[model samples]
Target: MKRPSAWHLVLAPLALLFALPLLWLLVSSVMTNAEINRFPPALIPSGIDLGGYRYVLGNALFPRWFVNSMIVSAVAVTANLAFGTLGGYAFARIRFAGSKLMLGMMLATMVIPFQLTMIPTFLVMKSLGLIDTLGALIIPSLVTPLAVFLFRQFFVSLPRELEEAAWIDGCGRLRILVSIVLPLARPALSTVAVLTFLSTWNDLTWPLIAINSDSNYTLQLGLTTFQGQHHTQWAAVMAGNVITVLPVLLGFLLAQKAFIRSLASTGLKG
Candidate 1:
């Protein structure tokens, strides 16, 4: 075999460094509690055990948390995509007073840290009696500034001639948007959908603050139940992390092609 170049040698180590933690998590998930708590961690378990997974899957509440997370993610993603697409279309195709100011203000909200607004948001949710309900989590994420900005940029890059042609054929703005632009904007829509889903799926802090009852806990927040001040179940914690992350990882894997295509196409237009 030919000798690999120095660039290949450098990249080989970098790739291993990035993947090592994930590889360790996979191995540790199958290890015994004793092995996980060993003075020096076992690089490889002597025997594979399903105890950790069994514990997690057997917990009746785990299933509920998983389902709640899905509900919040699904509802939030749908709202974001629907509103984001329409908002993007209106901002891109329609011209109205203070449009530039409004766009700038929306984008500015994206830069504001969530921490700054958490108290106010929580108060509002409390006032609306949405606290401790999944609605608290889903409602806030329904209109993400980032999703709106991305969709607007994507919409602006689309050719206006297609829309004008549709209009000339007696199609109204709503019909033209539905039949023409949305179909052509699939890649961008998919990109937004996947990103929104992942964000809502992995969300922990907001859900933690908004959700007070164990019955409405999300998967990510449920992981905290595995930790204790006196002793931590490292193996179970790792297992929960693995389970919590698997859906998101799988979702990205499924949508990666559409995401990359959208990024490439959007970049070209920008």
Candidate 2:
């Protein structure tokens, strides 16, 4: 059997260091509030206490928040994948006047921080009467420059011969894209889907600004209500966080292979 290298020895502890918090969170979620607040926190609980999870799940507002987050995330992922893939395919395969210039302008927007555009986005949402609605959260994040860039790069790396062959078969551009190109672009599509889902699922800042009504709050925004000025519910907060993180973790685990493959292939081509 081959022996482990020095690099593994160096990295193992670092990996564990980063994993400790997640481990702690999982452990702490089952702990009592009293156990959590003890002078020296218990690494392991005396007994499993599921009160936090029970409370969160039983709460009337939590289910609504969960549903809202799911709706927004689903819409965001669908919109980003559909639009980003189309825009990316166009930039990769189609040649038009000022295409390069337009692509450059789109890429440049990525460098502009979200904070700079937040006010303008909020105002626009207000003007459209989307404020305090799920639309406020979903509209602004439907697609991103990064998703477009990833799709374009992956599309560029594909052989032109395949597309040309489809064209020779009398396939129109949209037909070629949907029938030939997208079927082979699974990795890129998976990467975009996973990324869009994660971003929309975890987004808190924009929702905070755009949504005022408690009923419309996303999971992240709803979780904030657990923290009070005088006392915070650590167990409930941790339980809520675990619930919030599970979907993203499960999503990545399912799509991680394609995500990595797409990123590696995109980077190599670039």
Candidate 3:
């Protein structure tokens, strides 16, 4: 038998460290209030309690909030993919006036804190009559600089010969992008999609500031109701958070291989 690798000793501890919070969340969701409030905090519950799940699921508005989150995430992901892909491809291949300046400007915006732009974004959404609506959330996130940058990096590494050959065959630039470029960019596409979905689904701050109507609240925003000035429902909040994150967690797990592959490929080549 082969001797154990030394890396296992280091990795095992690190893995547990990262997993601790999520493990705590899962276990605490099923623990009684008395059990959870114990001084040391219970890692294992003596008995399971469904009180949290019941509390959250019993609320009629929960379903509406879930649907609202789904709509916003779906639209944001689709819009980012469509627009980011095009913009990235242009930055990667097409030579246009001030293209480098534009790319630099776009990348620069990514460094600026979102907190600085929130008020201006809210005002813009209000002027467009999108405030207090799902559109308010969707419109601002339709495309992001990170998404565009990822696509551009991935596209830049693609072989010019393939695009040239397509051009020789009289294929239009758009057609070439659709047929030749995108097929090979599956890994990047998957990465962008998963990232976009995760961001949009988990976003609460902007939605909170923009949407006053409870009916328009996203899942993350709706989960906040479990807490109030006097009473805080820890169990329900924990359970609601679990439900809120479940889809994003599952999507990441399923797409993790592709996601990692995309980033690695992008980093190495382009």
What lDDT tens digits, residue by residue, belong to model 1 across residues 16-127? 9999999898888888888878788777899988888887778778778989999999998889889998888888888899888988999888769999999999999999
Residue 128 local lDDT, model 2: 99
Worst 10 residues of 3 by lDDT: 225-234
Summarize candidate 3's per-residue lDDT along 66-125 as a digit string, tens digits. Answer: 999999999999999999999999999999999999999999998799899999999999
Ordering by TM-score? 2, 1, 3
Instruction: Say which prediction, candidate 1 or candidate 3, comes out ahead on TM-score.
Output: 1
Residue runs of model 3 more than 4 Å from their true location after superposition: 3-14, 32-43, 229-232, 260-270
Q: C-alpha displacement of 163 in model 2, angstroms?
A: 2.0
Question: How much lDDT does each candidate structure score?
Answer: 0.84, 0.86, 0.87
TM-score of each: 0.89, 0.90, 0.85
Q: What is the C-alpha RMSD of each candidate to the true structure, in Å?
A: 2.8, 2.4, 3.0
Candidate 2 residue-wise lDDT, 140-254, digit = tens: 8888988899999889999999889779888888899899899998878888887678779998899999999889989989988754511456787788878988898777677
Write down the lDDT that model 3 would get. 0.87
